[model samples]
Target chain A: MTALINLVYLISVSLFIVGLQRLSSPKTASSGNLIAGLGMGLGVLIALFAPMESGDDNYLIIIGALVLGSGIGLVVAVKVLMTKMPEMVSLFNGLGGACALLISIAELLNFHDSGTFGLAPYLTTLLALLIGSIAFTGSLVAYGKLSGNIKDSWKLPMANMINIILLLTLIAASIYQLQALDTMDLVYFIMILSLVYGITFVLNVGGADMPVIISILNALTGVSAALAGIIYDNMIMLMGGILVGSSGAILTILMCQAMNRSLLNVLAGGFGGGVSSAVQVGDQTVKEVNIMDASIILRYSTNVVFVPGYGMAVAQAQKICKELEDMLEELEVNVRYAIHPVAGRMPGHMNVLLAEADVDYSKLLDLEDANKFLNDTDLTIVVGANDVVNPSALDDPGSPIYGMPILEILKGKHVIVLKRGMSSGYSGIENPLFFHEKTSMLFGDAKKSLNSLLDELKTIV
Target chain B: MHLIIEILTDHLTILFALIMAIFLGFELISKVPTVLHTPLMSGSNAISGVVIIGAIILVRSSGSEDYISLFLGILAILLGTINVVGGHAVTNRMLQMFRKK
Candidate 1:
């Protein structure tokens, strides 16, 4: 029976691997998610048949929990808007972390009752507890930030100092527990401290940096689950956890690379605090373009590129933006979207938003491809994006976002920026592009602005 | 010292499994396109829900009188199910948008 279960575990692991492999591309991603879900279902069902010493029939509790959880999950999954994807992901990540943390705690209790003190089991349990606790609270904080429940202005003084001290204390306590094989009191103490650390660690990070924090927390949750797998000697758990852990790590690296910032730099907090008054916009006069003028410019253009940012998601302007794109296409103007990797709240946020608006995937160009297309484009329409297209990132070393990669939209023949007002971007950095020679500011709500522009284009065409 | 050595020897195969799984994870995910990053993340987030199995195992072995472990196990199972069900559902929903367009 054990051998048969192990064989099924092996097959389920293969399904997970194959599912992830299929998720790498656009065409198979949906089915890939289904395949992975199938693996999870099989693994959960087969776990019922696994050998256990206790004869207590707890199947009722298990089935009830599963049904209740599935009911809640299905409702939220169906009801959540695409704009809330990051928050939903963060919430689910937190649940996974909490699940792992609880499992480790339960196992530890069982081990204590059985008098099974050993270096291996205790070490894995401690690791899982620590990582799982952190991931849980950290993820919830991230969700709060993303959902606007936690304001960016909320800060704890000496945040970095506090984090370092808490971490050091956690390490010290963990060492003592391992050395002394301490009682449950010490374990509970460690868990509380870990949870506190999680909250403090993420509380100070500015809103713009939530993506990196989410990715890190996701990775931490995966690592904790993997540790739980080690404790239980379960191959499927081990494989799935490692896979998620690595994916999150890779994503963290990619996000950092997109912004040209290091992981440590992000974790240090204080990013996107507000505009750095030190770097002024100087004497460059701001250029303003009316809807009529902007429409005429776009209508006559041979090649036009749209740059989207988080504001597009906030104002729900993606559909209008897509409508503008279709209008331009009817005029025989070449239209494409330039998607900066870190453009929105999360990785690939703009792509998903645009895709939801029914924009063809092929019309979206990544950072590299978009830059190549921007070089010779007739005009660039920036919809609710600022920082990603800022020229200071390339030229002014004094700027806070100096070294980050930008769209270089100035390379095009003309530029039109649609925004709500003359404000700094999410990072609170002033954009020189707003005052540049070739740029024209079209100030309004992004969706309203796009709607007007679309109307004006109708008159022209 | 002898007990420590015994534990290490017993877990040697599991350790190897860990190392291989880590490598396989990195290799499989390294080539994913940026556009799919969101779905990939949510999908893999669901996979981490496999910890549900451990919760089940723990619950099954705990006696009914052991209220602490039973409560913890049930809660773990609940949260794990949410992660699995919601994560996959959300990822599929997002991917459906990408596929339809």
Candidate 2:
């Protein structure tokens, strides 16, 4: 029976690897997801059907909880919209953490009952408890911030200083607890500290940095789950946990590089708070163009590049934008999309958004590649995007987003920005690009402006 | 002395397993493109692989007299089920959208 179970574990691990590999491309992604799902389903079945000494009504309880939990998860997963995707991801990640936490606690209770407490298992349980609880609370806070249930930023004066002190105390107390070997009180204290740290760690950060926060928290949960696996001596858990942890860490590094920010800077968390109200535009004037006029410029353009951000997703304008792209191609306008690594609400969000519009994957150029074509492009349309293209990230040292690499779309000859108002973007930093001489603002709703642009282009030809 | 030695060796073995897992973990996900990060997040959540297995083993090992572990075990099962079932379903739904036209 144990060997059969291990065989099932091996199959599940291979499926997970294949699923992750196939997820890299558009064509094989769905089948990969199906394969991974099958593996997980088989794993659960083996666990459920394994013949064991059934206690009175134990199987019933297990089945009941399983059904109830899964029912809730499935309903929410299906019902959540694309705009709410980040929050949902964070929500599910938290649940995974809670699972690991509960399992570790269960182990601790059983070990105590059996009078078998070893140093290694005990320390691992404590570690799992600590990481798991933090992941739970941290993910919840991330969900709240993404969904606007919690304040993205609070005026916690010296928050960084306070966080450092709290971290030190947590470490000191953990060491003391480990030395004394008095179990319950110390475990509870560490759990509480972890939960509190999770809250403050996210609270000090504003909403703009949510994707990074969520990714790192997911990695923390992975590490915790791996620890739980260690306690249980479960090979599947250890392997899965490591995969999730490493993937998250690697993605975090890539995203930080894309933003030109350090992982340490991101964790420190005071940068995304609010735009300073005292800033000036330094004598640059704003330009406005009508839909017909904008269409004429785009129609005659030799090369056009589209840069999208979260606002495009919120406006659900990707389809219409794709329609415009098709029309431009009909006009023999060389068009391509420039995607910032951290463009949308989450990493890779813009890709999904554009992919949903049935945009060809080959046409989407990453940041560096897009910049290569930017200098020669005739018209650059900023569609409901602000921060990713904001020249302040490049030019102004005083700006909070300074040194963050951005699409140098100002290199284009003519630029039109479609936005609802003169609001600062997700980072709440003022965009000097909006005031640039080469840029023109077509201020309105993204979908509305996009429809207008497409209509005018079609009629002109 | 025998029991102490056994426990210490067990600890060492688990530690070795952990370091190896971490090393193997970093190697695999480095090549995943930026475009797939969203699906990757949702897909890997389904990878909460151990929760179900661990919960099952915990419950099976719990003597009928241990109600506390039984309760915790049930809770673990519930949470693990939600993560696995929900995570996979959502990931499939997202990946379906990525299919070629």
Candidate 3:
């Protein structure tokens, strides 16, 4: 039975590696998921019966944990929409960090060997405690911003200076506590301050930089885990900790580079401002087209491309998009969707939205593939998308979003934009995609505009 | 009975980490794009190699343990080695697919 348990543990770890590997590839990711899950289940089974633990009452604890955890997990799984996934991920990370912090604290109190509880253990624990607390609280604040539990973005006069002060204070406190190991109270007080600082610091950050922030928090969680493992002298914990810590650090660096910002810039709350508001386009009123007028333009077009963004998600217009696609196809016009990498709030936000409305995945084209098609497209129907299609990413070098590649919808023969108003996008930029010579603004709710367009399409056909 | 409880308490963190890793791993891989295929796969593969370090530490520390535990730890190290090597190889292959500036 002991041999069997060891074999199971080995197999479980192997599956975990394979699952993570498979996840990187699109083709075999789902299978990788199943394999990883199976590994976890097998590991639990081995642990349950392994000779290392000798409790007859184990069945009760095991069943109780599974029931409680699975039940809560099921509820969260079923309730959360794809749109809320980033926030959900933050919450999940917070829980993990919280666990690491709690375990470390517990281990400190139960420290058996006085000699081993010297400088190294104390320092690692202090570092872990500080980082983990920050991760926990910072993730919560991030969740708040993403979930709209608080104002999405705010600015402070000297936010950077304050963040630096708080960080220095936390570090100083950690150093003080390292030498004063006998004084648990001071250690805890510093931990509290650091944790609070972490919360406030993260709260000051806007929603746009959340992806990288979450990755950073994840790395913190790993560091905390490693520290806890060292304190407890646990091999599995150390392995898991090192893995999470290094990978998370690398991921944070990668994410920071991808966004063209430094880790310091990210920490200093210097990264994102809102989308640019529409500047003075004096005396030029945006031309609005009713359904019939819009269809008249659509009727003659040889090729049509639809662009969907966050507004499309808010209005749940994906179904209507497919409806419009089918209607346009009936008129012998080719229709395609131009998807930008960062089109919606999170990565793949647009794809998930489209998939929910049962849009054919094949019609969704990546930015590179779709960029070539935009030149040949006769009509570009933009549905509630803004900054992604902004022309400033190209023509205006002075613009904040200048370097980011945008879909060249202006190249199309005719462009129709669906918007609620001239309100800025998440990046706070007013798009010139709204002001193109061939563009006609159809201002309303995305779904309503599409419904009206559907009626108009019937009349034109 | 007490010994069993001790074991469970000691290893609780490891157990939870495994569960969380599995869950998060599944959720993430399900949605990766074809463009990110190489990096994502290789990253996860490399991550798996953490098991090797864990095995080494366990084997080195458990000086008083029976031969069975030592054997199992060695097995873990071997498995972890496979992950590190294979994961790095795959990642390098994937990186080659991208056009370099």
Candidate 4:
């Protein structure tokens, strides 16, 4: 029995490694998932069959739990939309943390003698309990913020200061509990306080900061798992936990860099709803053309660049955009799709949408790669995109998104913007690119505008 | 020589597990150039054979008291298999869509 259990553990670990590796790339990610699922199966098999000393004949209890948890997981995995993935990920991480906390608490309660518990077990148990509790509540808050159940902006002022005070209190309580070895009640009280504090701290943070927070919370859950493994003296759990912890930390840091925000600022709840209202339009002489005229210019241009944004997704114009590109290509005009990192609500949102439309992978260039070509291009068609092409980022210091790298689409010989109306993006900043001399606003749905452009192109051909 | 083999055998289980992890990890992260994400995601869904084998091995070897474990393992294996098959079918459909003239 022990041998089989050990074997299963070994197999599960291997699957987990493969799963993580596959996740790095779009191509093999599915394969990696399958391998990971295999590993999880192995782990569950070992955990269930491997004889525990617990004399409770609670086989029915365990079976019931397995059924309930698996059923819930199955429903979530099958029914959840891709748009809600980040929130789902946060919820999943919370479940992991909650499971870790429950198991650790059970272990602590079952401890017959406090004297038998060494420094290693005690320290690990305490750390796991603290981190798991934080992750569980933090993730729930993130889910709420992302799903719009909670307000997207700052709910309370001086929230940071309050969080700091609560943290200090939790720390002092933990220290006292550690010192006062006899008071189990004190430890329990400290744990409960810290759990509430964790939830409130996350609740105060806005949705804009969730990407980084989610990654950090995931890492915390991993740490909890590792601590749980230490408590159980399980090598498989230890390795798996470490892998998740390290990788999650790396991912969190990367996300922070992508947004050009410091990890410290993200943790301190620096992001909120109210955007800076300082408009800096210093008489940079501009001209605006309507949709029909913009199409005429695009038809005659030798080279054209299509820039897509979050608005494209809202309009579901990916297919029409592709058709326009095809039409442009037919006209013997060079065409390419310029994508910005933060173009959509979530990372890879642009990529997924474009992929769905079967856009040529080679033609799709990142912000840095595409920025150089935009200046020389005869026509830069800004389709349902705003903030990414906003020139304010480059010129105006007072702009909220100042110094953030953006595709300089305004520099192109001719620019046409496909937008329904003058609406602010997620950052709630005005795009001066709309008023630029070389730019034109084609006011309508992106799909309808692009379809019209395609028709115009066909007639010209 | 005997000692070396004994040491290898003792840790062989762990070694094999790590190797599988390494392979899967490598395979997972190799992003299908953004263009391939849809097909790849769908394709990977069908690779449930590994889970099935693991579950079968576990249940067959598990003792009487391990009934709960066996049941859970079997259930996991079934779900994993379904995910793999369904994922691949979706990938195929997605790819076929692109091929439409």
What TM-score would every model get versus the actual structure? 0.97, 0.91, 0.75, 0.75
For model 4, the stretches where C-alpha displacement exceeds 4 angstroms are A1-4, A112-115, A204-206, A271-279, A282-288, A300-304, A314-335, A357-360, A373-376, A381-386, A397-400, A444-461, B1-101
DockQ of each: 0.77, 0.54, 0.06, 0.08
Candidate 1 lDDT by residue in tens digits, A1-461? 87888888888988998898888788888888988888888888788877776648588998999999999889999999998999999999999999989988887877778777678888899899999999999999889988999987788998999999999999999888877774777788889999999999999887667777878888999999999988988888888899889989988998888888988888888454553544577666799999899889988899999999888888999999889888889899999999988877777888889989999989999989999999889999898888889888998877778889989899999999988888788777888888888999998898998899899888877
Candidate 1, superposed: residue stretches over 4 Å from native: A270-279, B1-7
- Provide chain B's TM-score, model 3: 0.59
- TM-scores of chain A across the candidates, in order, are 0.97, 0.91, 0.86, 0.84
CAPRI band for model 2: medium
Tens-place lDDT per residue, model 4, A1-461, is 77777777777776766665664554555565556556656665665566656443344544554565556556655665544544655666665666555555544543423356544466567777788788778878877876778776646577778788888888887767655557467667767876887677787654545656766776676667666665666656655655566555655655566566787777766544466646755555445566567778877888788898867876888888888888778777788989875565444556667766878766788776788888778898887777678788888887766776888887679888877877666566777887776777777888888887777667766
Residue runs of model 3 more than 4 Å from their true location after superposition: A1-7, A46-63, A112-118, A154-157, A226-259, A270-284, B1-101
Please state the error at residue A272 of candidate 1 in Å.
8.8
Backbone Cα, N, C clashes tallied per candidate: 0, 0, 12, 23
How far in Å is the alpha carbon of A365 misplaced in model 1? 0.5
Which 10-residue window of candidate 1 chain A scores lowest in summed lDDT? A270-279
**Could you give candidate 3's per-residue lDDT for residues B9-95 as a string of tens digits?**
655766566556545544544445634432442344244333333334334444333344344444444433333433333333333
Query: How do the residues A1-461 of candidate 3 rate in per-residue lDDT, one tens digit apiece?
Result: 76665576668766756765565565555555456555645644554444443213224423443445445544564566655655655665565565555444533443432335545556656666777678779878877877888676565557777778878888887777665566567767876886887777887665555656766776676666566555545433454455556545555655455345678776767434553433545456677788888888888888889998777877878888988888888888888899876565444557656755656667788777788999899989888777678888777765666766778888878889998888777666666666667889898898999999888889868
lDDT of 2 by residue, A1-461 (tens): 87887788779767766766666566777887788777667666776676665444366677788789889888978888766778888888888888777877787665666666877677788788888888888888888887777865453677788789878988888778766775577667777888888877877775556668878887887788788778777666777787778777777887788778888788787364554534487565688989889999998999999999878887899999899999999889998999988887677888878877888878888888889989899999988778789787776777877788889998889889998988777666778788888888999999999999888887999
